[model samples]
Target: MLDELRNDPVILSYLQERANLTKGKIAEKLNIDTDIHTVCVHHFDYIDTLRMMMFYLFQQIGLNVVFYIPFNPNAPDVYKTWREIYERVSGCDYSRWECVESSQPNRGTKFAQYLDKCFPHQEDQLDNIRFLSFNHPTEFKEYLQKNPIVNNQNEVIASYEKDLNIYTDCTKSDHFYASRYGKFFLSLQNCKKTEDGIFLTYDDYVNMMTSGWVQYGSINGTQALTLLVDLRDYMDGVESFQNIMERLQSLVYLQEVSQVFDEVAKEQAGRHRLKCYLSNPFRCFPYVHQSRYQITVKQLIECTKDLARKVNRLLLAEREKKNVQLYLRELYKIYLTVKDKWEPSAKQKIEKLFSIHIPDHWEFAKEELYQLLTFYLGSTEEQENKILNFDQLIGKTLSAENIHVTGLSFKTFPWKTPELPSLLTHTWLKECIRCSFIATNQNIRINALLVDYYSRNVTRSTALYSIYHLLAYGNGQITFSYIKDLQENDGPSIYFMILEELYNKEKVNLEEQTEEFSWEETVTTQEEIPKEPLRNIPDLLWLDSDFCQRKFFLNAFVEHHPVYENDFHQQQAFSIIGKLLAEQGEGEELFRETMFPLFPQWTNAHKQNLLDTSYSSGLRTYK
Candidate 1:
């Protein structure tokens, strides 16, 4: 029958694929009636029919077979298969086969116990059962004690230590374990302690190999952090420095490991002790939290300095361009982490680090230095001194032709300092204005400095252009005293520039105030000021003090330009003057004395009436 079944293609394929046997092998095994004493069956989804058929064949041949079926009350098909197998095997002669029942519902432990019960008298048969089991820890402990790896206690301890040393060595050297032998050896080392000694069990070994740490022999910094975080969740308290370091060094880069150490030191209680341990590993100490691990401000600053030096060395080497940026950013982050812990003495070191220059990499380096300086030397005095020092340094290095102050804005340097303008050379000032004009957040300060630069070094076309550029874009409040000073010292060009601006502004305001008035229509009727330059104009006339100089400029303005002698221009000019004089409490005699010579066409009655009308609450008019 078996030979006939082998000729069937379905049976042949099932034997080859599922049972891992050829037709001839299956036939050979089927012919051996007495050789098969105890057959163990494990569940496989595809080979369920094959397994059942094989069990039925074995039962018909009066072979003792034990099927390890896991108890799943939720799975009715599994229970149905078990019942079928039980009925089929039990229906055979009861003397040749035996069915063992497990009292416990947990199928994990039941399989092993049921196997021992099925082959109680045959020690060799039980040994040859060769099945895997999942049992409780207590049951595994019982099995370990019954079957010890070593007969005595000393050998057990020796074996444990030997294996532990091997694991420690492998971890230290970052050695990859062998596929088969290493796994088996690790299993042996995963033994549980007993009253007599330590004993190995299949379940304990499996659990150890599957633990989060041992699952992956090697890990990186991020992975190590994940494992540490997981352990933090499971463990009750902080782990020891030795334990933490061993795991971290085995997994991550040495620098990353040091960073992790620093992180742990920040949160844990034994920071000083951990620091000492990391510094000198030869000294031995127990795993206890020591409260004396205080990190001083000076020590933190020195540590940050060391990191900065490392970054500097990388920069000096000019290799690892990618790592250079990354390390520089990280170094700055570390500085920020401990920035508040800076001592006064650490300023020199920080400044020294800041002074190191890397060509083409000066932007980020300057940014980091700016941040550090802002944090450490935050006082106004210290910042001033540092700015002066930087200015002197910059002045020495600044060239005549190529003045590329790209990153030197007000935020980067103290551009607003009064001394900065004096300390920097004229060439540097030009470059600073050019760079600061575009990059500064506070344009008012930059504009003020430009004005200062104009006052001192007015010869530079760049300074003049900077001042004019500021005025153009400065939102039209040209109220800086420097503008008046420019008018006094430089010439009337600034005065005319301001007057032109004010004229255009007043026209716009009048147009806005009176929507009925058209600017283009008014321009045709109003007299145009002649383009000839007006000379001998007093400087005080441009002053904004009490509108006195402005009124004076207006009077001088119409007198100098005869084309502006029309009634509209004269009335507008004299009306403003009358209002000013009335507000100043000047009598009509004074008004006549001040203005009749300026305006000879006006009668005394007309001038006094203009004055009286200007004093009225309503708008003043002239006939």
Candidate 2:
């Protein structure tokens, strides 16, 4: 029979067209099936073969052919057609013929019989099935008061829906919703609303049947089943669906990019290749087709470009950080080489260190380098024996009174090098000055070095402002002289700015001391005073120089008065003026002159109270 079917041109063409198989392949498959006891026939491909001939051949070969028919007992036409097929195939061989019925109760009569047997006392079986099918747990329980049998078909469906809900409810279960729902719920939560309708996603029906939850059947011993179920409703617009899909795709792409970045960050070779790969837009758009991702081609391009830009920035910053560390390591090596010898060769190496161009992001490296150089320069005792002047050796002209160093001119000093200004900023200079001051025991040498360096650097104003507070730590005579020179050269405004900063720092120290000893007596004699000066006066007579002291008091009073608008600067100014007045014992005169003229609104009582408190042992009036 198989040979005849393969030779007939009409049958061969029909089989090829219907089964998508060649005549030779169909004949081969048929011959193979003949030796088997059971034969499987595709329900859809039944029409492609002569059914009677196939069945007769199966019987002749003592083989049984199985047909998985989707039975619908309620429809007469469907029932009649299947019955006719069965009768025609069975023929007159009643002895060999058989009919196997599915165990499921399909018809109402069969279902009634099942309910009667399983739940004999149940009267509302119909209502129970309806309630369970619609997921109305409340209605199902109410109907169960009269009792109902557990019908196989309805119970299987109810169990499936229950398990599905438990699985999709991410709050309860950790199942991968994307694998079950077609798309992740987190991405779906960002869905937009529109007027027409809320569009829905296409659920992965194939995954549902194969999911372990369904394949393992119900825990209650219910039969396993597979059915096309619409788990989610479509209430969003098409645009919303597309938007959600695009967002999901973007999230997936970003995760991939992050993984690549992490890998690149781990290896130098990977980082070198990152820039080239980052520039290519297609690298982030690996899954760009509509079938795999619903995003449009234009959107995919835009997203890739945005991701590439962001990733490139991250890579650039990473590279800059790495470069900064490398430069700092090189600078440290040069410092070590020149630590002991201050010879011409060592100076040439130091000159090369400063000659390299500094990138802005390497500000930390620049700071560290300046600190290292300052420490090394200050530590070496050979400078006095070298015969170079302080100016030539340090590349800055200083007052002879500031630092009397005797060192011969070192021709290899990097004074002639062009990148000196680029190597130093206001911050770097400040750090250098601090290191030098500490190393030299708050000597005028550091101040003079800074004064000379700032005179040559374009950032003199900023540099001066940064180190202004350091003057308070210097000797009284030198501080007074420096203030006098700054007032004369940079005008009274810059001088006043310096005074404000100095007094502000002093005020904070005074307040902290007061709080520490506030429990002591309200009044103590000047000599009995905690032996610690009320404040370490960097220049006791600096403020006693009537002209400078009076001018600063007046400026502070006018700017920080209560009637005047208050801000952080005003509060700071107020604290500075209060501390100076209380500590200097000159508040009585200043208030009578400066305070009275500024605000005449004060009464006699207010003036007397202010004077008494300012001259008291502690800052009673300020608090």
Best by TM-score: 2
TM-score for each model: 0.16, 0.17
Residue lDDT tens for model 1, 1-623:
57866886778887666545334444576786344456676422112222445555554455566655423233323233333333343344323444365443221122222222332221211111111121222332333344332211101111012222222211222211222212322443333333333333323323322322121112211222223232231222212222222332322232333344455655553544433333321111111111222322223223323422332332222121233344445545544444343444443444444455445433333334334333433332311101012222212222211111111111222123233434666456556657766644334334433434333332222222222222322221222111112112232233223423432322111111235665655445678876555445433333423466555554456322111223445454456555655455565457566544433334567656666665433222321
Screening candidate 2 with a backbone cut-off below 3 angstroms (N, C-alpha, C), the clashing residue pairs are 197-236, 198-235, 198-236, 198-237, 199-236, 199-237, 387-407, 387-408, 388-407, 388-408
Q: Which pairs clash inside model 1? A: none
Per-residue alpha-carbon lDDT of candidate 2 for residues 4-115, written as tens digits (9 for 90 to 100): 6588788878766654533344457767643356666533211211344444445444666665432334332323333334333333322344446534322223222221
Per-candidate clash tally = 0, 10
Q: Any runs in candidate 2 off by more than 4 Å, and if so which?
A: 1-85, 88-155, 158-623
Worst 10 residues of 1 by lDDT: 151-160
Give, for candidate 2, the lowest lDDT window spanning 10 residues: 219-228
Please report, in order, the local distance difference test score of every candidate based on alpha carbons.
Answer: 0.33, 0.32
